[model samples]
Target: MFLNKNRFFSNTDLIGFALLALLIFVMLPVGLDVFRLNLFGKYLTYAFVAIGLVLCWGAGGILSLGQGVFFGLGGYCMAMFLKLEASSPEATKIQSTPGIPDFMDWNQIAEIPFWWQPFHSLTFSLVAVIIIPVIFAFIIGVAMFRRRVGGVYFAIITQAIAAILTILIIGQQGYTGGVNGITDLRTLKGWDIRTDDAKVILYFVNGGLLFACLFIAQIIRKSKLGRILIAMRDQEDRVRFSGYDVANFKIFVFCAGAAFAAVGGAMFTLQVGFMSPSFVGIVPSIEMVIFCAVGGRLSIIGAVYGALLVNLAKTTFSELFPELWLLGLGGLFIAVVLAFPNGLAGIYKDYVEPRIALIFKRKMHIDEDVSKYDPLEAAAD
Candidate 1:
């Protein structure tokens, strides 16, 4: 049902996908130690959010700046379960409440909250990671899109929601983790997640999940729905007059972005050992948008690279420059936006692809002219 008839993705996309797979799964894993690989794994989680943005903002023209809300929700869901495991009666003998999370105890909560009790089950926690965020997205989508609320208004609303959620998390210190967030997450179903071997395994899991999301994004991009999204992005009135419910489409994509963010959040908690309000706020959400924009939001694969490069620069420059790091990053983002609005993907499209065709021309013995194939060009004729 989801198969594409060789539609959107051409050889260019296939090659892009292959190269990314090789780098994330093969090259990086082999070259870097477990510590460095885990750091990259953290960055890859951000790629999930960036890919979601490709569909929401890039294809559908829905710019949601509150993606961190979903990401944090997902991470917190996973963290809830892990914290329960780590807060077993034996482990929390020091606490007043023998089986409650440390934060809950610190806040003087006497019993595990009913909502949190369900997360003690791994199955429920796993489902909640994706389902909860998607549900929230659905409500927001319906409220906004049904009312024809969009453009910058929608963006502002999402950003405001991120702020509200962050405040809520911090205010409800007993139930949520407050400013420190959920911490000391240990073991997943009795497997020690803090070990070096466990970190490597989790890194691979993160990479595998990223590919799954990327493939799903490609399939959506190449399908009929994807085309409709593009059309709607460009000419909404025309699509609305053509007997399609545009609001539903926007809602679906927005919710889908939330779901992707949820998975990333869950992976982040596993790899980073914590989930905090710091990740669920306005600043991180804006940074997520930066990831999508810098990556060339139109290209899912480019989003992944963008997340890696931006984060790589973040880690490297912050360590080296410390005080000057923010200035450097701001300058870099400004440079990319002003000089190369299309971003890394746009650069490749204009410069790298033509060169590739030139290189292949030498290899093809009887080729007069051959294109790698661009869908938009074909569509114009």
Candidate 2:
């Protein structure tokens, strides 16, 4: 039933996006202090991951449980560049090896690793942030979707990949900084990112990038490829038999999702000042999926809201009631599942939209009757 649906943006979509723009660019910035605003900026990074999930899981029916893998990869890429810049020989003069990163010097590594060399160039790191995730996602998508392996099997495989990456990062202390992960990141290209001014600037940049992703996702969701994805989700066998290479489409969308996530990761590194395996593991990956589900997997805009609201709640609850925070989160998840499967967007679609449509219909009917009854009409004729 949803396959033939092509209406991209109703009046509802326009209004929703407008409000989101206002909230991000004006309301939050005006209402909050620098510290609080920076926290919101951190939340906005997660919105990138949520937006990706809207495309891959919502529109394309690919439930990837390892989004954090891409996010961490992108963040680590950016962090490596920043780390190198911050670890210049002059900056690290106190260390025994005055040119290497602090962690490496502490770990007694004699020289920079070969793989870390590429990240010394900002241009290369930026490209790698997007390309690396796309390649990794493409490999996984091809392996699974080609053989018709999907559903829960696909989810499990993605989760396992997340686990393996976390383990590897933790094990390679000499390379990855071990359980401590990457820390002490201070500057970017000689600019002090820890300053209040930089924080505000980064927040705006993060918001701008998020909206760009949203626009791209909307275009994809309304295209012919989008319809086919829905078709495959509902009936993969039918789509394949109809001569479509379903696997190829799945790979494309999954890679697209990973790219979105990579951007978020890089932004997280810039704004939050570190990258760690803590973000690339099972807990974080699952939480990222929850953001999409709560936002309404089918609705791109809703996913953004879902991420912001969930993260906001997590911070507030954990701060106010540390012991009860998990309880609150569990209840929130249950409420979303049991009460609103379609999420915030579903509520708008079912209740709010109908009222708006009814008002418009009534206004049109009144205008038609008034036109017919115009007394000046006869005299003019």
Candidate 3:
């Protein structure tokens, strides 16, 4: 009966399905609690960023060091809308302070900047979260990929972009919120963001989004485009010679990855209820890369696991040994890299595959002996 089923339901598929089901079941209960739920939501956001890294660095061999730029762009977009909604009607009319955010006061600015106008609408801000990062990535990808820039050169360029973005945000005191980024967010769509129910709902939403992303990533990994991406990663010059537009592919993936980061950023803003220039700086960008590396860059599941594990450790270490948190994290990274260069996913594979293979081998040996030896021969032996 089992043999009559579709071949696609192999051992790996069964195991994967079982694991996913378990994860959902376990998360459902934890998500019911506000604090744990919020923590999980944060992890989901980090998972989204890590997934973007998986696509760019793992699949495309493009190490984007500026993912935080896209993340910050989306975060600020949502933050602006929230701020606009939170402001009083009378406050919205004053030219200098009209719908002016609190940060303007810190900068001693009297009026709202013209550029902050479009973000007044929730719809526009949401749309911009997806669009702005994509557009930025498209332009950057075209320029760099067209010039055949990659590897360390590509990484360095992206890092510079992140650094510059951070500086620009800090310098643009009035508009960009300067050092003390957008804060004191009270609500979302009139719902008290600080309430426990809202937090649980957010957690469920985050879990759903994480699952959806995993499904989409799995589909992409199995599709023809995924194969092409792997081909590009393995031999870009050969792929170009084979009539494929390598530049276009690279740009597409970059833009897609950026969009993913933007989504994560928007969601993160909702959970954290604030956006800061520091969130988009070089250190955060590097941290995103570290999440992907610690997870297993090539595997989406690995990325999720890595983000959760790393963030959980961060929280624990910070609570228990605040001063030693960075040291412990650094040591953890070094240990993972040395032990399983391919990341935590590799460790899982190594542990599972050999055990499964051993079981199958033992079963096969038993069957072979049963078939080869007659009852009389066995008795004589």
Candidate 4:
């Protein structure tokens, strides 16, 4: 009975999945050029984080301001493995140290750091991409939720963590590639990812992974666990009094959110071909939250659209009106907050979705009326 209730697809799920399929497989591919499609691919990476925020902040009511930290961690882990492969002894003969990365050699570090040694194993890095962020989130969630620390205090702490991590990455120049970040990525498993064909393949792979996450999210949203989260969010004391371990639920959702962000980060590295501290900083972390807010924090499907539209606007405005891009972005955010606090998804739910539902209901009712009234049809049957 539990399994049946948690079954993957509902009526709304089918519609949501179909629209996503049309967008990913048909519309974007047919309409956009290669370069533009690739840019949209980049935007899709952010959608992963935005959707994660939907689970963490929207449903769970845990507003993590340090999601970019997880995203950066995942990207950097992938970048490290690629960087090691790209900087083989044969490739670095020009440098003083033949086997080490160029950045290390440039910064006068003769040997690889102890920490970086593990990234040479691609398998380890792949596991670390998900595991590391999950671990970090677990630690943070346990510490904060157990102590009953939340709201603005939790946000401030996460923001501080983002600032600290960004500074550390910049300060550890030799170890981390410093401000330049881990670049010069060439191939993954001997196949050149820089090629247009590879980009297309990666984009599809990304879309598949995203849909997988979305399905998992839908399952969670429809399950008892998801209800517990919403209950904890709205009435923590009532939940705790009912003998539910509230902290555990918070920690689990937070870690899941972190894991999602990390996958997005890894995908961002693959699609963009670099990972940098710029994305790990306070500004980017806060921007990720905005992506969720603008999408309708409560709507997972809306989150994807929000990320795509916001990034599209950013790219378009930044190119055409470089001087006024920030101003425009600020105004857009202000408008979203003031006019539609629930976001694009809320608007759709309140207005557009009702009309669509009415049409379907009318058709269904007509079919029912015909079956009831047509005595000749019944006799034929």
In the range 45-162, model 3's lDDT, one tens digit per residue, is 8888898888888888899999999999988888888876676556446544555676775567776677778877778888999999999999999999999999899999999999
Residue 299 of model 1: what lDDT?
85
lDDT for model 2 comes to 0.88
How does each model score on TM-score?
Answer: 0.95, 0.93, 0.87, 0.93
Instruction: Identify the runs in model 3 with alpha carbons over 4 angstroms from their true place.
Output: 1-14, 90-98, 360-381
Clashes of each: 0, 0, 3, 0
Score residue 83 of candidate 1 by CA lDDT.
Answer: 93
Q: For candidate 1, lDDT tens digit of each residue in 1-381?
A: 123335566767889999999999999999999899999999999999999999998899999999999999999999999999999999999998898899999999999989988998999999999999999999999999999999999999999999999999999999998999999988999999999999999999999999999989988888788888988999999999999999999999999899999999999999999999999999999899889888887889989999999999999988998988899878877987899776788888878877777887888764746544454643311
What are the per-model C-alpha RMSD values against the true structure? Answer: 2.6, 7.1, 7.2, 6.5
Q: Per-residue lDDT tens digits of candidate 4, residues 342-381?
A: 6888777667766676677697774433232233321111
Candidate achieving the largest lDDT: 1
* Best model number under TM-score: 1
Residues 103-154 of candidate 2 have per-residue lDDT tens digits of 8988899899999999999899999999999899999998999998888999
Model 2, which residues run further than 4 Å from truth?
A: 1-8, 360-381
Worst 10 residues of 4 by lDDT: 372-381
Candidate 2: residue pairs that collide: none
Error of 2 at 62 (Å): 1.3
Which 10 successive residues of model 3 have the least lDDT summed? 372-381
